[model samples]
Target: MKTLTRKEFIEQVGIGAAVLFVAACAGSCKKTAQGPSSVNFTIDVSTGNLATNGGFLVQNGVVVARTSSGSFIAVAATCTHQGGTLNYSSGSNQFVCPLHGAIFSSTGAAVSGPTSTAVQKYNTTLTGNSLRVYS
Candidate 1:
């Protein structure tokens, strides 16, 4: 049988620890990037494609949807359940999380989902072509 010397064992342990450290770092780094906890921004609704009804835009991790009635709504793009990116369904007027089928209403209310918590909503102001959304 082969036995490792004390010095050799120490070197192997150090290498193993380094490998484990690198692996952990890589795993943690692969997480989905989250947006700012708080948002404050203004958008020109008149100039961009968002001017039309049912138009939606994602900026700063916020989803701004222009409803069919020509009104603007803003909600956090991240899903409350699992931080999945959200999409607006104009046909249903709801936000859907692609991760786990979580659904939210236009008012950021939790309609149906794995999570009972509602997504964060932002206040919006529309004046002429300028639209402001803030948390």
Candidate 2:
């Protein structure tokens, strides 16, 4: 059997490391596009996070939020930056991407980015306990 010398082993390790690094970066930086198109859905806001001001929930690829002022907003649930799942911050009335600190307004405009594109926004309406989200 052949055995590698120290120089040969180091070179092999370096090459392997470079390959792994490239793969990791490619996967990590890949933008994830998710959410509904021609969006139309209903959620009962009488319970769960949607029931209260400054609360939120994600359903059917939409992030729905109730602002501190008791109004509702809906936006795509995936971050435009790298497909990170978005979280609604009612305190700031913004959608935030956990992966890269991307900030988006409740209307789905990109406030900051590793992404230049804005997430699509959906229209929201409330009737009794039924909240409808649509494009």
Q: Write the per-residue lDDT of candidate 1 for residues 3-24, one digit (tens) a residue.
A: 9999999999999999999998
The local distance difference test score of each candidate is: 0.85, 0.87
Per-residue CA lDDT of model 2 for 25-127, tens digit only, reads: 9868744334678789999999999999999998888899999999999999988767898999877899999999999987788888687667888899999
Clashing pairs in 1: none
lDDT of 1 at 88: 90
Listed in order, each prediction's TM-score against the native is 0.69, 0.73
Q: Report the poorest 10 consecutive residues by lDDT, candidate 2.
A: 27-36
Where is model 1 more than 4 Å wrong at Cα?
1-37
Candidate 2 local lDDT, residue 126? 97
Report the C-alpha displacement of residue 63, candidate 2, in angstroms: 0.3
| Alpha-carbon shift of residue 111 in model 1 (angstroms) | 1.0
